[model samples]
Target: MDWMRDWVQAVRECEGGALGTVLCLALLFVWYCYRVGCEHASYTPESRSSPPELSSAKLRPTLGGVRTGGGASEEELNGFAYCQSPECFRCSRPGNGFNQRLYHNLQDYAKRYTWAGMGRVHKGVREQDRYRLCNRPSIQKAEVFFLPDLPSAPFFSRDAQKHDVELLERSFPALLAEFESVYRTPPPLAPGWKANSTPRGHWWTFYLVNQGTTLALNARRCPRTWRVLGQLRTFISNNVFGNACFSVISPGATITEHYGPTNVRLRCHLARLFTLDAASRGERRLRPTAGPERLH
Candidate 1:
């Protein structure tokens, strides 16, 4: 009976100590939460007399209102966008104004800026930019004695990329399927022009032609793309002076602002596939099962 009483007393003491500790912890947590809530409720915007600088120690801004690198996620940006302020990013205006960036990479900022620039121009500022392609100096014809110029043929006409587009349209499904099959397959990642990581949603490239040269190995790997490009050899034999590859920029991935070395080439994007919330944004989602009026 004495041993039983002693054991009971020890258990009671331990339980009482544990209960007191738990209550103390609970009170501390409640106080912390209360302090946090009070701080949030009392928060006010800091004076914005000066332009916000995002760390002079890092993230140097580049030409064309681009920054090389930063630290932010799309989710954070989206949450900010939902705030009552009418700012493009974190302010109270439609325009971000003065080299504002949202994404970690400058490319995303450029794309978003371009998207904003697509809107109707207000006052003197246009969201869109117009820049001329700089002709390649080395490829300049001595007899011509001037900058290189493309043929004056209508671009979409039968003589131009019409056949190429048609063939690609026909083979788009096969390309999509093949891409889905081989894009993430073991050892399927082709080298990027800028070797970004896999987590950055690889800028995967399966070259049909590169710098006026056909890649026999890559073509063998991607037969459908090869067949589609093959159909345009007659039209593109001479004009295929530069790379012709499908550049698949991964979702939420951003490539920095860059201009090709030569203006003699134009990279073409045949088709795009993305998933987005169509209902909220008042845009229709084009699904494979949806009415394909133009598929015929």
Candidate 2:
């Protein structure tokens, strides 16, 4: 009992707080070393006896040839070349089934897009605008669009006239007069628009409603225009086609070919306006603006 009491006194004199702090620091140091070792193990490379799963199994003779002088591995000796196909195995080889069909039973035709001799000409060193137009016979000759099915019984007979044309005819004269009134005091054309104009003058837009889908502005001043639009509101939703305007392109004014943000709806042009709707190979719709024309 006396020896035990002496041991306890010795420990207290040695300072137990210092001992505890040292032990805590030692533990933290060990943990940090363990974390560093784990990180080192992750980056270290390991040699595999077999190739990666993504690599092809079989190989043939390639023009790149065997490793000439160095002590190379089996993979290095087997030179690789990529044919113009995704399923190609042998690189630089004469025939690795570059144009092979996936299913033997399937029809022999261009199933999807395949690279068929593309030119790689960068304009500048950095300008890498690649254009790969599909010139496949199967793709080009495919019957894509079909005519809309119609009923034998006609909705309107030969004598039956369109109501829309009649409505336009009724409102045309009044609208024309109002347009002349608006034209008497036309707003100054936007600066950028004048430069882009083909006639070297300016193309103007008289907005009945603003481009934004809110309350109709400037439509109130033109009552006749508003009434005609109200009659057609049943056909077109106010929420959708709110922006209505009469674009006045002068005799030589030519707006460049362009596309709107969305192609959900077709633009409604009332009069003799030259319009060309062409879809690119990428399915992007290219819109041609009204060319220079004499307006009556």
Candidate 3:
């Protein structure tokens, strides 16, 4: 009974000590937590400045006004000036004002007779070529006209007549032969005629007179020429212009540089004769003179 009592007392004393230790430890822990929390609350997050609000109306500027200079001017900011601005006009206008006006007027005039339908046979040519032939989407039947310098009067009596390729084929061969005979020999290699040195081979060309009345037959007289003309007619009816011309460029022939009167015309070369290695091949444009005599 004495041992039992002694063991109970010892156990009670140990339990009491453990309880006190636990209470002290818990108090220490609470103190540490409270200190950390108080420190965190004391260090409030640094206040941040808000970004400036942009006005929607200020995004695009008025036409004549200068832009805010954050870096470049708005015109400079966009990397290019607006097209309608007077500054843009001043910068972008062509150097030749008179020529520009003349060109614009000529374009307006050309719109009246320009073909609006797909080109008759050369439609399959390159897009660039087609554009050169006619600016419109398709060539209409009544817009064909002859150059005024032709030996004969204009052929078409009225604009109502449809252009027939068959007739052209029957007539173009003689003209081809004539052109061939005259241009067959190798072209001159002189400085002024540099385009004459390229190798050339003969080829035929037929034009559909969309607006003209000049019969293909009117251009020829001989029977053999008529046969050649017939071939041209057949090709035209079939809508084949890919192989029509025989192109030849002299070895070193440099065609002087000159822009066509309008962007609608494409130049085609039929190679009838050529030299193998002469320096006269292809077209070249001469530089314009700096002074009043601009011989280009």
* Residue pairs with backbone atoms closer than 3 Å in model 2 (clashes): 81-91, 199-252
For model 2, residues 1-296, the per-residue Cα lDDT tens digits are 99999999998977887888899999999999997776444232341233222223222344544433333323433322122333222222212131222222122322353324211111111111100111112211111111122122212331232444456557866776666566555346322111222213456767775333423545655689778876762234443334566666654443422113122223344553433345455542324353322211
TM-score of each: 0.38, 0.33, 0.21
Name the lDDT of candidate 3.
0.33
Best by lDDT: 1
lDDT for model 2, on a 0 to 1 scale? 0.40
Alpha-carbon runs more than 4 Å astray in model 3: 1-95, 103-168, 189-247, 250-262, 266-296
lDDT of 1 by residue, 159-189 (tens): 3445555666678888777665545542343
Model 3, backbone clash pairs (residues 3+ apart or across chains), number: 51
Residue 76, candidate 1: C-alpha displacement in angstroms: 20
Candidate 2 error regions (>4 Å): 1-162, 189-200, 212-217, 233-237, 272-296
Candidate 3 per-residue C-alpha lDDT over 166-217 given as tens digits, one digit per residue, 9 for 90 to 100:
3443444454565444343443421111121111222222322211222344
Off by over 4 Å in 1: 1-160, 186-202, 233-240, 276-296
